[model samples]
Target: MRYYYAEHQAAYRRLGREGMTQWNDLFGESWTFDDFPNRVFLESVLDRLPASGEVLEYGCGTGPAACFLAARGFRVDAIDLIPEAITLARRFAQERGVTVNFSVQDVCAMPVGSKQYDVILDSYCLQSIVTDPDRAAVLAAVRDRLKPNGHYVLSTAMYDSDRVYEDDFRYDATTGICYERSTEPADDAVQLDNTWYLPHRRHLRPKALRAELEANGLQVLSQQGELRGDVICTPTRRG
Candidate 1:
Protein backbone atom coordinates (compact mmCIF):
# COMPACT_ATOMS: atom_id res chain seq x y z
CA MET A 1 0.00 0.00 0.00
CA ARG A 2 1.10 3.53 -0.66
CA TYR A 3 1.77 5.97 2.16
CA TYR A 4 -1.64 7.57 1.75
CA TYR A 5 -3.48 4.24 1.76
CA ALA A 6 -1.47 3.00 4.72
CA GLU A 7 -2.27 6.12 6.67
CA HIS A 8 -5.93 5.81 5.66
CA GLN A 9 -6.03 2.17 6.74
CA ALA A 10 -4.43 3.01 10.08
CA ALA A 11 -6.85 5.86 10.64
CA TYR A 12 -9.74 3.57 9.80
CA ARG A 13 -8.63 1.04 12.40
CA ARG A 14 -9.30 3.54 15.16
CA LEU A 15 -12.91 4.58 14.46
CA GLY A 16 -13.40 6.60 17.63
CA ARG A 17 -10.07 8.31 17.05
CA GLU A 18 -9.79 11.93 16.11
CA GLY A 19 -9.55 11.22 12.38
CA MET A 20 -12.86 9.35 12.17
CA THR A 21 -14.48 11.66 14.68
CA GLN A 22 -13.78 14.62 12.45
CA TRP A 23 -15.04 12.80 9.37
CA ASN A 24 -18.29 11.92 11.10
CA ASP A 25 -18.63 15.41 12.47
CA LEU A 26 -18.48 16.59 8.88
CA PHE A 27 -20.83 14.11 7.17
CA GLY A 28 -22.29 11.83 9.84
CA GLU A 29 -25.54 13.62 10.50
CA SER A 30 -26.33 13.81 6.81
CA TRP A 31 -26.32 10.00 6.54
CA THR A 32 -28.07 9.57 9.87
CA PHE A 33 -31.07 11.63 8.72
CA ASP A 34 -31.54 9.65 5.50
CA ASP A 35 -29.20 7.12 3.92
CA PHE A 36 -31.19 6.64 0.73
CA PRO A 37 -31.32 10.27 -0.27
CA ASN A 38 -27.62 10.86 0.41
CA ARG A 39 -26.45 7.64 -1.21
CA VAL A 40 -27.46 8.61 -4.73
CA PHE A 41 -25.25 5.98 -6.33
CA LEU A 42 -26.88 3.26 -4.24
CA GLU A 43 -30.44 4.16 -5.19
CA SER A 44 -30.67 1.23 -7.61
CA VAL A 45 -29.17 -1.17 -5.09
CA LEU A 46 -31.65 -0.09 -2.47
CA ASP A 47 -34.48 -0.58 -4.91
CA ARG A 48 -33.40 -4.10 -5.89
CA LEU A 49 -32.57 -5.38 -2.39
CA PRO A 50 -34.90 -7.96 -0.94
CA ALA A 51 -37.03 -6.67 1.89
CA SER A 52 -35.82 -9.29 4.42
CA GLY A 53 -32.70 -11.26 3.83
CA GLU A 54 -29.01 -11.45 4.66
CA VAL A 55 -27.37 -8.40 3.07
CA LEU A 56 -23.65 -7.78 2.94
CA GLU A 57 -22.41 -4.25 2.56
CA TYR A 58 -18.94 -3.54 1.24
CA GLY A 59 -17.27 -0.38 2.45
CA CYS A 60 -20.19 0.17 4.76
CA GLY A 61 -18.58 3.22 6.33
CA THR A 62 -20.08 4.12 9.68
CA GLY A 63 -22.97 1.66 9.00
CA PRO A 64 -25.80 4.09 8.21
CA ALA A 65 -27.03 2.00 5.27
CA ALA A 66 -26.72 -1.19 7.28
CA CYS A 67 -28.63 0.41 10.11
CA PHE A 68 -31.23 1.58 7.62
CA LEU A 69 -31.64 -1.95 6.25
CA ALA A 70 -31.69 -3.47 9.73
CA ALA A 71 -34.42 -1.08 10.81
CA ARG A 72 -36.39 -2.22 7.80
CA GLY A 73 -36.04 -5.87 8.99
CA PHE A 74 -33.10 -7.09 6.98
CA ARG A 75 -30.14 -8.95 8.47
CA VAL A 76 -27.05 -6.97 7.62
CA ASP A 77 -23.34 -7.76 7.64
CA ALA A 78 -21.35 -4.61 6.98
CA ILE A 79 -17.63 -4.64 6.26
CA ASP A 80 -15.08 -1.88 5.81
CA LEU A 81 -11.34 -1.55 5.48
CA ILE A 82 -11.17 0.74 8.50
CA PRO A 83 -11.52 -0.78 11.97
CA GLU A 84 -12.59 2.51 13.47
CA ALA A 85 -15.40 2.69 10.94
CA ILE A 86 -16.54 -0.80 11.87
CA THR A 87 -16.39 0.04 15.56
CA LEU A 88 -18.49 3.14 15.04
CA ALA A 89 -20.91 1.13 12.93
CA ARG A 90 -21.26 -1.43 15.68
CA ARG A 91 -21.93 1.34 18.15
CA PHE A 92 -24.50 2.83 15.83
CA ALA A 93 -26.24 -0.53 15.46
CA GLN A 94 -26.29 -0.97 19.22
CA GLU A 95 -27.66 2.51 19.78
CA ARG A 96 -30.40 1.87 17.23
CA GLY A 97 -31.23 -1.50 18.85
CA VAL A 98 -30.52 -3.26 15.60
CA THR A 99 -28.48 -6.41 15.13
CA VAL A 100 -25.83 -5.74 12.51
CA ASN A 101 -22.45 -7.44 12.24
CA PHE A 102 -19.73 -4.98 11.40
CA SER A 103 -16.35 -6.40 10.45
CA VAL A 104 -13.08 -4.68 9.75
CA GLN A 105 -11.56 -6.36 6.72
CA ASP A 106 -10.12 -5.43 3.38
CA VAL A 107 -12.52 -6.05 0.50
CA CYS A 108 -9.70 -7.41 -1.62
CA ALA A 109 -8.87 -10.06 0.98
CA MET A 110 -12.29 -10.94 2.34
CA PRO A 111 -12.07 -13.91 4.70
CA VAL A 112 -13.52 -17.22 3.62
CA GLY A 113 -16.79 -18.42 5.01
CA SER A 114 -19.34 -21.12 4.21
CA LYS A 115 -22.21 -18.66 4.18
CA GLN A 116 -23.13 -16.45 1.24
CA TYR A 117 -25.40 -13.44 1.41
CA ASP A 118 -28.57 -12.98 -0.62
CA VAL A 119 -27.58 -9.46 -1.57
CA ILE A 120 -24.24 -7.62 -1.69
CA LEU A 121 -24.01 -3.86 -1.73
CA ASP A 122 -21.00 -1.99 -3.11
CA SER A 123 -21.49 1.75 -3.10
CA TYR A 124 -18.65 3.75 -4.65
CA CYS A 125 -15.95 1.55 -3.09
CA LEU A 126 -14.54 -0.27 -6.08
CA GLN A 127 -13.85 3.04 -7.72
CA SER A 128 -11.45 3.82 -4.92
CA ILE A 129 -9.18 0.99 -6.01
CA VAL A 130 -7.42 3.56 -8.21
CA THR A 131 -4.43 1.52 -9.29
CA ASP A 132 -4.80 -0.77 -12.32
CA PRO A 133 -3.08 -3.80 -10.77
CA ASP A 134 -5.60 -4.16 -7.94
CA ARG A 135 -8.95 -3.73 -9.75
CA ALA A 136 -9.19 -7.23 -11.24
CA ALA A 137 -8.41 -8.97 -7.96
CA VAL A 138 -10.90 -6.87 -6.04
CA LEU A 139 -13.69 -7.62 -8.51
CA ALA A 140 -12.86 -11.30 -8.50
CA ALA A 141 -12.88 -11.48 -4.71
CA VAL A 142 -16.33 -9.87 -4.61
CA ARG A 143 -17.62 -12.34 -7.19
CA ASP A 144 -16.28 -15.31 -5.27
CA ARG A 145 -17.88 -14.13 -2.07
CA LEU A 146 -21.36 -13.79 -3.57
CA LYS A 147 -23.81 -16.68 -3.67
CA PRO A 148 -25.18 -18.13 -6.86
CA ASN A 149 -28.27 -16.14 -7.94
CA GLY A 150 -27.22 -13.45 -5.44
CA HIS A 151 -27.54 -9.77 -6.30
CA TYR A 152 -24.56 -7.41 -6.36
CA VAL A 153 -25.57 -3.79 -6.13
CA LEU A 154 -22.94 -1.32 -7.30
CA SER A 155 -22.88 2.45 -7.83
CA THR A 156 -20.04 4.56 -9.23
CA ALA A 157 -19.67 8.13 -10.40
CA MET A 158 -19.04 8.48 -14.11
CA TYR A 159 -17.48 11.64 -15.52
CA ASP A 160 -19.01 12.41 -18.89
CA SER A 161 -20.06 16.00 -19.01
CA ASP A 162 -19.80 19.13 -21.11
CA ARG A 163 -18.84 21.15 -18.09
CA VAL A 164 -15.16 21.89 -17.64
CA TYR A 165 -13.16 23.12 -14.65
CA GLU A 166 -9.74 24.78 -14.27
CA ASP A 167 -8.24 22.01 -12.16
CA ASP A 168 -5.99 19.09 -13.01
CA PHE A 169 -8.14 16.10 -13.96
CA ARG A 170 -6.98 12.84 -15.48
CA TYR A 171 -9.08 9.90 -16.66
CA ASP A 172 -7.80 6.53 -17.77
CA ALA A 173 -10.42 4.52 -19.61
CA THR A 174 -8.29 1.38 -19.73
CA THR A 175 -7.70 1.24 -15.99
CA GLY A 176 -10.85 3.18 -15.13
CA ILE A 177 -9.00 5.53 -12.80
CA CYS A 178 -10.04 9.17 -12.57
CA TYR A 179 -7.81 11.58 -10.68
CA GLU A 180 -8.82 15.15 -9.90
CA ARG A 181 -6.73 17.72 -8.11
CA SER A 182 -8.17 19.33 -5.02
CA THR A 183 -8.62 23.07 -4.50
CA GLU A 184 -9.18 23.03 -0.70
CA PRO A 185 -6.89 25.34 1.24
CA ALA A 186 -4.31 24.02 3.69
CA ASP A 187 -5.83 25.08 6.92
CA ASP A 188 -5.83 21.60 8.54
CA ALA A 189 -9.40 22.28 9.46
CA VAL A 190 -10.96 19.40 11.34
CA GLN A 191 -14.16 17.64 10.30
CA LEU A 192 -14.82 15.38 13.26
CA ASP A 193 -11.16 15.86 14.08
CA ASN A 194 -10.04 14.15 10.88
CA THR A 195 -7.44 16.28 9.10
CA TRP A 196 -7.13 14.30 5.87
CA TYR A 197 -6.87 16.07 2.54
CA LEU A 198 -9.34 15.18 -0.19
CA PRO A 199 -7.34 15.31 -3.36
CA HIS A 200 -8.36 12.81 -6.10
CA ARG A 201 -11.57 11.08 -7.06
CA ARG A 202 -11.66 7.81 -9.04
CA HIS A 203 -14.39 5.76 -10.73
CA LEU A 204 -15.07 3.49 -13.68
CA ARG A 205 -16.92 4.31 -16.86
CA PRO A 206 -20.31 2.65 -17.45
CA LYS A 207 -19.08 0.33 -20.18
CA ALA A 208 -15.94 -0.70 -18.34
CA LEU A 209 -17.77 -1.43 -15.12
CA ARG A 210 -20.33 -3.57 -16.90
CA ALA A 211 -17.63 -5.51 -18.69
CA GLU A 212 -15.82 -6.23 -15.45
CA LEU A 213 -19.01 -7.45 -13.78
CA GLU A 214 -19.94 -9.64 -16.72
CA ALA A 215 -16.47 -11.12 -16.87
CA ASN A 216 -17.05 -12.29 -13.35
CA GLY A 217 -20.33 -14.22 -12.81
CA LEU A 218 -22.65 -11.23 -12.50
CA GLN A 219 -25.05 -10.28 -15.31
CA VAL A 220 -26.50 -6.85 -15.73
CA LEU A 221 -30.18 -6.55 -14.95
CA SER A 222 -30.83 -2.79 -15.09
CA GLN A 223 -28.40 0.16 -15.06
CA GLN A 224 -28.82 3.91 -14.82
CA GLY A 225 -26.24 6.69 -15.10
CA GLU A 226 -26.67 9.82 -13.01
CA LEU A 227 -24.88 12.96 -14.02
CA ARG A 228 -27.51 15.62 -14.48
CA GLY A 229 -29.77 12.65 -15.24
CA ASP A 230 -30.15 9.25 -13.58
CA VAL A 231 -28.87 6.19 -15.46
CA ILE A 232 -29.40 3.12 -13.31
CA CYS A 233 -28.21 -0.47 -13.95
CA THR A 234 -29.34 -3.53 -11.97
CA PRO A 235 -27.74 -6.89 -12.74
CA THR A 236 -28.68 -10.38 -11.66
CA ARG A 237 -26.39 -13.36 -11.06
CA ARG A 238 -25.72 -15.71 -13.99
CA GLY A 239 -26.49 -19.33 -13.17
Candidate 2:
Protein backbone atom coordinates (compact mmCIF):
# COMPACT_ATOMS: atom_id res chain seq x y z
CA MET A 1 0.00 0.00 0.00
CA ARG A 2 1.11 3.53 -0.62
CA TYR A 3 2.49 5.30 2.46
CA TYR A 4 0.13 8.25 2.41
CA TYR A 5 -2.94 6.08 1.91
CA ALA A 6 -2.01 3.91 4.83
CA GLU A 7 -1.02 6.84 6.99
CA HIS A 8 -4.23 8.76 6.23
CA GLN A 9 -6.42 5.76 6.94
CA ALA A 10 -4.68 5.17 10.24
CA ALA A 11 -5.30 8.72 11.31
CA TYR A 12 -9.02 8.47 10.50
CA ARG A 13 -9.33 5.11 12.16
CA ARG A 14 -7.93 6.59 15.33
CA LEU A 15 -10.22 9.60 15.08
CA GLY A 16 -13.31 7.49 14.59
CA ARG A 17 -12.44 5.07 17.34
CA GLU A 18 -11.41 7.76 19.80
CA GLY A 19 -14.50 9.88 19.12
CA MET A 20 -12.29 12.72 18.04
CA THR A 21 -13.91 15.23 15.73
CA GLN A 22 -10.95 17.17 14.45
CA TRP A 23 -9.02 16.01 11.39
CA ASN A 24 -6.41 18.75 11.32
CA ASP A 25 -4.38 17.28 14.13
CA LEU A 26 -1.28 16.83 12.07
CA PHE A 27 1.73 19.16 12.52
CA GLY A 28 0.28 20.32 15.85
CA GLU A 29 -2.40 22.36 14.12
CA SER A 30 -5.96 21.94 15.32
CA TRP A 31 -8.45 22.92 12.63
CA THR A 32 -11.14 24.34 14.85
CA PHE A 33 -13.74 26.98 14.07
CA ASP A 34 -11.58 29.64 15.69
CA ASP A 35 -8.70 29.01 13.30
CA PHE A 36 -10.09 27.42 10.14
CA PRO A 37 -12.44 30.20 9.05
CA ASN A 38 -10.04 32.93 10.00
CA ARG A 39 -7.17 31.53 7.92
CA VAL A 40 -6.06 34.27 5.52
CA PHE A 41 -5.95 32.05 2.48
CA LEU A 42 -9.16 30.29 3.40
CA GLU A 43 -10.94 33.62 3.78
CA SER A 44 -9.70 34.59 0.35
CA VAL A 45 -11.17 31.39 -1.04
CA LEU A 46 -14.51 32.04 0.64
CA ASP A 47 -14.58 35.51 -0.88
CA ARG A 48 -14.08 34.04 -4.34
CA LEU A 49 -16.86 31.47 -4.10
CA PRO A 50 -20.30 32.17 -5.50
CA ALA A 51 -23.09 33.13 -3.12
CA SER A 52 -24.63 29.70 -3.59
CA GLY A 53 -23.75 26.82 -5.87
CA GLU A 54 -22.81 23.16 -6.13
CA VAL A 55 -19.37 22.44 -4.68
CA LEU A 56 -17.08 19.47 -4.37
CA GLU A 57 -14.24 19.15 -1.84
CA TYR A 58 -11.63 16.71 -2.96
CA GLY A 59 -9.93 14.73 -0.17
CA CYS A 60 -12.25 16.05 2.53
CA GLY A 61 -11.26 14.24 5.72
CA THR A 62 -13.73 14.93 8.53
CA GLY A 63 -15.89 17.36 6.49
CA PRO A 64 -14.89 20.65 8.11
CA ALA A 65 -14.75 22.66 4.90
CA ALA A 66 -17.66 20.78 3.38
CA CYS A 67 -19.86 21.34 6.42
CA PHE A 68 -18.75 24.93 6.59
CA LEU A 69 -19.89 25.56 3.03
CA ALA A 70 -23.09 23.55 3.46
CA ALA A 71 -24.10 25.35 6.62
CA ARG A 72 -23.98 28.55 4.67
CA GLY A 73 -26.32 27.03 2.01
CA PHE A 74 -23.87 25.69 -0.55
CA ARG A 75 -24.64 22.19 -1.77
CA VAL A 76 -21.53 20.17 -0.93
CA ASP A 77 -20.19 16.88 -2.19
CA ALA A 78 -16.92 15.58 -0.71
CA ILE A 79 -14.85 12.48 -1.19
CA ASP A 80 -12.00 10.75 0.65
CA LEU A 81 -10.08 7.51 0.15
CA ILE A 82 -10.79 6.23 3.65
CA PRO A 83 -14.18 4.80 4.55
CA GLU A 84 -13.47 5.66 8.16
CA ALA A 85 -12.94 9.26 7.22
CA ILE A 86 -16.24 9.32 5.30
CA THR A 87 -18.12 7.87 8.26
CA LEU A 88 -16.70 10.47 10.58
CA ALA A 89 -17.36 13.13 7.98
CA ARG A 90 -21.05 12.22 7.93
CA ARG A 91 -21.11 12.54 11.69
CA PHE A 92 -19.30 15.83 11.54
CA ALA A 93 -21.85 17.17 9.04
CA GLN A 94 -24.67 16.06 11.32
CA GLU A 95 -23.06 17.76 14.28
CA ARG A 96 -22.74 20.93 12.25
CA GLY A 97 -26.44 20.65 11.31
CA VAL A 98 -25.53 20.63 7.65
CA THR A 99 -26.17 18.13 4.89
CA VAL A 100 -23.19 17.06 2.79
CA ASN A 101 -22.79 14.32 0.24
CA PHE A 102 -19.74 12.43 1.45
CA SER A 103 -18.28 9.53 -0.48
CA VAL A 104 -15.32 7.21 0.02
CA GLN A 105 -13.33 7.29 -3.15
CA ASP A 106 -9.85 8.18 -4.29
CA VAL A 107 -9.89 11.54 -6.04
CA CYS A 108 -7.30 10.24 -8.51
CA ALA A 109 -9.76 7.62 -9.72
CA MET A 110 -13.13 9.13 -8.89
CA PRO A 111 -15.80 8.71 -11.56
CA VAL A 112 -17.01 12.06 -12.84
CA GLY A 113 -20.53 10.91 -13.63
CA SER A 114 -22.37 13.84 -15.22
CA LYS A 115 -21.98 16.14 -12.26
CA GLN A 116 -19.95 19.23 -12.80
CA TYR A 117 -19.48 21.45 -9.78
CA ASP A 118 -19.26 25.23 -9.71
CA VAL A 119 -16.28 25.02 -7.39
CA ILE A 120 -13.85 22.24 -6.46
CA LEU A 121 -11.53 22.40 -3.48
CA ASP A 122 -8.28 20.67 -2.63
CA SER A 123 -7.69 21.27 1.05
CA TYR A 124 -4.04 20.42 1.74
CA CYS A 125 -4.27 17.29 -0.38
CA LEU A 126 -2.09 18.10 -3.35
CA GLN A 127 1.22 18.02 -1.53
CA SER A 128 0.50 14.52 -0.35
CA ILE A 129 0.40 13.38 -3.96
CA VAL A 130 4.14 13.16 -4.56
CA THR A 131 4.18 10.87 -7.56
CA ASP A 132 3.89 12.53 -10.95
CA PRO A 133 1.22 10.24 -12.37
CA ASP A 134 -1.06 10.41 -9.34
CA ARG A 135 -0.71 14.15 -9.10
CA ALA A 136 -1.62 14.50 -12.79
CA ALA A 137 -4.57 12.17 -12.37
CA VAL A 138 -5.99 14.14 -9.48
CA LEU A 139 -5.63 17.38 -11.35
CA ALA A 140 -7.32 15.83 -14.37
CA ALA A 141 -10.17 14.71 -12.14
CA VAL A 142 -10.57 18.25 -10.86
CA ARG A 143 -10.72 19.54 -14.45
CA ASP A 144 -13.17 16.89 -15.56
CA ARG A 145 -15.57 17.50 -12.68
CA LEU A 146 -15.62 21.27 -12.94
CA LYS A 147 -18.09 23.45 -14.82
CA PRO A 148 -16.80 25.58 -17.64
CA ASN A 149 -16.44 28.63 -15.43
CA GLY A 150 -15.80 26.74 -12.23
CA HIS A 151 -13.00 27.59 -9.88
CA TYR A 152 -10.53 25.24 -8.24
CA VAL A 153 -9.32 26.35 -4.84
CA LEU A 154 -6.25 24.76 -3.32
CA SER A 155 -4.11 25.07 -0.19
CA THR A 156 -0.66 23.49 -0.09
CA ALA A 157 2.56 23.61 1.87
CA MET A 158 5.24 25.27 -0.22
CA TYR A 159 8.95 24.75 -0.04
CA ASP A 160 10.25 27.06 2.63
CA SER A 161 13.32 28.73 1.19
CA ASP A 162 14.53 29.84 4.56
CA ARG A 163 14.36 26.49 6.27
CA VAL A 164 17.20 23.99 6.21
CA TYR A 165 16.44 20.29 6.18
CA GLU A 166 18.32 18.19 8.76
CA ASP A 167 18.07 15.27 11.15
CA ASP A 168 15.21 12.94 10.26
CA PHE A 169 13.93 14.83 7.25
CA ARG A 170 15.74 15.96 4.12
CA TYR A 171 14.67 17.36 0.78
CA ASP A 172 15.85 16.53 -2.71
CA ALA A 173 15.77 19.89 -4.43
CA THR A 174 16.16 18.30 -7.84
CA THR A 175 13.07 16.07 -7.70
CA GLY A 176 11.13 18.33 -5.32
CA ILE A 177 10.63 15.33 -3.08
CA CYS A 178 11.03 15.31 0.68
CA TYR A 179 11.99 12.17 2.54
CA GLU A 180 11.42 11.31 6.17
CA ARG A 181 14.15 9.16 7.66
CA SER A 182 12.96 6.30 9.82
CA THR A 183 14.49 3.50 11.79
CA GLU A 184 12.14 0.91 10.36
CA PRO A 185 11.45 0.54 6.68
CA ALA A 186 7.98 0.67 5.27
CA ASP A 187 7.09 -1.59 2.39
CA ASP A 188 7.22 1.38 0.04
CA ALA A 189 10.15 3.12 1.66
CA VAL A 190 13.47 3.60 -0.05
CA GLN A 191 16.68 2.39 1.55
CA LEU A 192 19.60 4.69 0.97
CA ASP A 193 22.93 4.98 2.80
CA ASN A 194 21.72 2.30 5.25
CA THR A 195 18.83 4.52 6.31
CA TRP A 196 15.19 3.91 5.55
CA TYR A 197 13.53 6.94 4.01
CA LEU A 198 9.87 7.37 3.28
CA PRO A 199 8.65 9.50 0.43
CA HIS A 200 7.04 12.40 2.19
CA ARG A 201 5.25 15.48 0.86
CA ARG A 202 6.28 17.35 -2.24
CA HIS A 203 7.15 20.97 -1.61
CA LEU A 204 7.75 22.66 -4.90
CA ARG A 205 8.87 26.16 -5.51
CA PRO A 206 5.78 28.26 -6.22
CA LYS A 207 6.75 28.92 -9.82
CA ALA A 208 7.38 25.26 -10.54
CA LEU A 209 4.17 24.25 -8.82
CA ARG A 210 2.21 26.74 -10.91
CA ALA A 211 3.74 25.36 -14.05
CA GLU A 212 2.58 21.90 -12.97
CA LEU A 213 -0.97 23.09 -12.39
CA GLU A 214 -1.01 24.70 -15.82
CA ALA A 215 0.41 21.60 -17.43
CA ASN A 216 -2.39 19.61 -15.83
CA GLY A 217 -5.02 22.07 -17.23
CA LEU A 218 -5.43 24.39 -14.23
CA GLN A 219 -4.57 28.00 -14.80
CA VAL A 220 -3.83 29.60 -11.47
CA LEU A 221 -5.56 32.93 -11.04
CA SER A 222 -4.02 34.06 -7.78
CA GLN A 223 -1.98 32.75 -4.87
CA GLN A 224 -0.77 33.85 -1.43
CA GLY A 225 1.89 32.98 1.15
CA GLU A 226 5.39 31.52 0.89
CA LEU A 227 5.67 28.57 3.27
CA ARG A 228 2.03 27.78 2.81
CA GLY A 229 0.27 28.93 -0.33
CA ASP A 230 -3.38 29.14 -1.13
CA VAL A 231 -4.29 29.23 -4.80
CA ILE A 232 -7.43 29.82 -6.83
CA CYS A 233 -7.58 28.68 -10.44
CA THR A 234 -9.75 27.63 -13.35
CA PRO A 235 -9.45 24.92 -15.96
CA THR A 236 -7.51 26.01 -19.03
CA ARG A 237 -9.39 26.06 -22.31
CA ARG A 238 -7.60 25.01 -25.48
CA GLY A 239 -8.40 26.07 -29.02
Give the total clashing residue pairs for model 1: 19
Residue-level lDDT tens digits of model 2 in 98-154? 899999988767765788999998778888888777788898888888898899988
lDDT of 1 by residue, 186-208 (tens): 33211212323332445556676
lDDT for model 2, please: 0.81
State the lDDT at 19 in candidate 2. 67
Runs of candidate 2 with Cα error greater than 4 angstroms are 37-39, 162-166, 181-191, 194-196
**Highest-scoring model, lDDT:** 2
Q: How far in Å is the alpha carbon of 182 misplaced in model 2?
A: 6.3
